[model samples]
Target: MNTENAKPQQRFLPPPPGAEYPLMGSAVGGGSYNSHLVAGVLFIGLAAIGAIDWWLVAWIDGCLAIGLLLDRRTMNRKIALRAMPGQMLLYSQVALRAAVHMFPYYAFAFVLYLGMAPVVLPLNFAISSFVMLYGFYMLLRVYWLVHYLWVLNFRWEHAGRTFQTHQANLKTRRSAIQHVLWAFFLGNVGLVVRCSSQVITIAGFEYLRQSLNLDLTQHPTLNVHVMSIFWGTVVVWLATFWFMLQPTFLIYYRVHRTFHSCRPLYDSVHSIHHRGVLPTQLDSGTISPLEFALTEYNLPAGMLVPNWYWTLGQIILAFAGHLPSHDTNTWMKTGHHHLLHHRLFNVNFGLIAREDKRYGSFYCEPPQAASAPEPSGEAAPPARRRHAVAALAGEDD
Candidate 1:
């Protein structure tokens, strides 16, 4: 050991548990799987039965209304008798009310439409066209409705803390490509894989419809009921997957977020998604990631469905778009929604940032946005923390 340098000391650092080694990048991307449709076969079969006898769908819608009322009463009693926070009740009430309200409207419309079935049979494509337009309105209504209540109003545990407190720490830089890739991977792959299962099913249905040339309406006189249930079901299913499948993306994006971090870009676009703190149907995939690769696959791939049915289904999907939980509600109203996630970070789930009204879309802020200045006043992103080095892999001078 004495001579010129002898044997060098062995420097060793064991890898972290769970992950075989340190995760060098901010995010890892490309562990993807296919997802498109799994509901196709079931929907086709269901649509076939419904086409043959529309009464079943009506019965189900009726039963759902009754069940919701019963559940509402149960929760109301718990709130009234036990004197609980009524947190869940607030969201439940709105959702349940919407459910019940939509039921009768749908039923009445169906009955009225049935009456005109004989005459409207000839204009089957036209009927699908109308349904598409109306359904989109319903979806948007639900999104904002959820936003007004649970998503926009709730506060978190560390509600007022900011980035200036931690700015000294994040001198190090993290690889940006990593997180961006991750956003695509989990969301694109994880979610798509699940959704593809459903998409393929619909694609199969499209193939069948083309082969069989089936129509959904029972009126035989109008060229085999021009409206086909198979197409309609695919419309709803694909749109559902498109708008409501962001949990997978958020998971990849939020994989690195912590209660204490110097960089707070997660606060910009992503934090609002986590606002619901506790997730529920009210706070489920509320944000739109439709344009992202994970979802955009619906474009060429989605063309498999009939044009009219697909168009109408997109309308109904418009309703569900905002109905689910979102992280955007806060930014929509005051841009403060995302910061809330930095504070409580775990409580508000149905959060959405409802800003613009027309031609709206799902919004995602990059994870590095903390350093960027906010265009709006009254809201300054909290300063970066020193811990950002360790987490973000630190940028040295």
Candidate 2:
């Protein structure tokens, strides 16, 4: 059941020759055997993000994921199980593309960040909070787009087309206690990692409160040019990157042949999640009751910090906000890693593993939508429904 001939549904960019249908079936061993190195590296990144500073860790994560995904031209090369000199060169080129693509925007945001809070110090809280949340939505948008096109729609059973039917139900099968533990541990991890930055920031600014108290006329000296925009933009930027790929981590525990098959894609675990290609507000932390607590893992401290009495509680808020709305990858866009993990035994191993580059999947297939019309609409007979825009319509390909 080689799924590799399925053709590409929609590419973020033009794929290399064979990527169109790289995985078709359950071929256990071949030149296709996936490497676990990427998975190991990702987990290492996760542990670092959890163990050290979330801000720096998240920035590195964003640079790498965005670097990898946005650089679709070289995905086949860099993400491959075996790295050749040719692949290394391709990776360098892709990295250059990513720098060209993401840096200016990063700089603009960075420039604005320094000035944003300083000019609006009195209003920094309100502005920063909203910007951060909005930024998250954008990240998830990319997540949704990638997952929808590349990962979910290419299943061997469906074999190379998008599923139009709306999906429902995303229940998890683990015990109540397990769910509780998952939520509690993961949430605590997120809260501590993501929120600690704020605690540190506050510590840096601890003198502000005192300065204002000691001399009402001597307001804290906040550099309007450098630090202002950073106040709001940095948080938004980090939140977007940190959470956008989080589902990658959580989904790992549920799936993976190395672990137990506690969940499946077409079933409750991921079905409801894949219902929409364009995720909206409802999609935020929208998992089942058993998994609801997982949402709290990625929350930013800005929202709840003001309401809490202890500074540590504010820190906790920042940490809890790491999941849910925080994730940039939506079920529609970048959930391929999770979805593939279910439908096929190999490939798409969440954020941790991407065996797809090596072996392809059991259902390695993607083709023009079955409803694809000829370039000249006149060449094609009129159908009952208008053709849906392709997955790669706006993509680089």
Candidate 3:
């Protein structure tokens, strides 16, 4: 019996009848619930001992969220390890490394946001909005300066790396309007909303009690109940990174796609962004105010979350996240999806491939691109671009 050419079998045998694996069972599902319980107990215990405050809780929750995310990634890797092809396995390793590299940027953004707390926390609504507007403008200008230097030193060297030859749409009336609105209006509005929400959450409770002339004095347990509600809400909101972040991104994608489809809106507003066909960091802030409001700042959590730090995180994610995708010099290959979107104009609408994959719009590096003529400043017509995308995606003509 020669076994030299035999192919190995990949068997899937079910567990024997009545078999129980308590360790695996606990790790799979019970561990997550147990963590929540432990976290709640720890939070309450710390509060009881005067060892923890809101600031501490915020940092703790962020660290816990990252831990949980990494744990899940480990579990997923274990489950999928045998199924991944060699190339895909290599890609996954690279992606993990890139994430590790990007972590410092997240930390920097966090530190920057924290640095602004002293300046913005004490001001009233009117004064804070003014400050935020000025601060936002300064932030945009500083980033622009950084990108300007980046391009000056590196652009020629990286020219071959760019997706297209078209230049960034700078020094135009459209660019000016986008800069003004994105910096002065949309971002400032979001900042003020977060600040106001924080103030209202803290003082409004006391204000309500005084205004109604009814107190928690009648029932001692009522005070406990009110406090429970307050702390519970805070804990839940703190843990939102584990739950709400993905859905928020999905919602933004849907709204962004919708705005693109609305011709009247696109022609009047959304087109301002599209003008920067080969977007650089300068174009990151070049979006219409209405589009910005409807997309980035549109999340209910932006207005409702009492944690201004969380709101600040959202702002950085919205603005800074756009920069790498818009710039060609980044070694991170994740921007290809968006650079393709800019080129084709009607595909790759989502940040990740999931949405486009489901909607039959995923264009996996068009074949013609290898020998295709140099891309021009003008974008392909909508219908032609859609056809090209459909063809590339292997859909019917």
Clashes found in each candidate (C-alpha, N, C closer than 3 A): 66, 64, 0
Cα RMSD (Å) between model 3 and the true structure? Answer: 20.5
**Which tens-of-lDDT digit does each residue in 1-397 have in candidate 1?**
1221111111132212321112222321110010111112333366576532344334333433342232222223221212112322322332343334344433333333333333443443344432343234335434533433332235322211221212222111121112212222222212222223223434344355345554334336754644454344445545554433333223222222221121222222233233222222222232222112223232333333443555555544432433222233322332333333332232112224321111121123332232343422223222332223223221221
Reference-based TM-score of each model: 0.25, 0.26, 0.45
Q: Candidate 2: where is the Cα deviation over 4 Å? A: 1-40, 46-80, 84-89, 119-397
Candidate 2 vs candidate 3, TM-score winner: 3
lDDT of 3 by residue, 1-397 (tens): 2222111111122322212111111111111112222343465576678854655445434533443342322223222222223323332333343334334433332332232222323433324332344355447656665555554345634533332332232334333333333332223322322323334332333354456653544457655565554455455545653444454455445545543443333333344355445455444554543344334432332333324444365446545544554344555434656656655556566667676655445554432331144432222234555454333321221
- Name the candidate, 2 or 3, with the larger lDDT value: 3
Among these predictions, the greatest TM-score belongs to: 3
Better of 1 and 3 by lDDT: 3
TM-score computed on alpha carbons, candidate 1:
0.25
Q: Which stretches in model 3 have alpha-carbon errors above 4 Å?
A: 1-137, 146-221, 224-227, 238-243, 302-308, 325-334, 366-397
Worst 10 residues of 3 by lDDT: 20-29
lDDT of each: 0.29, 0.31, 0.40
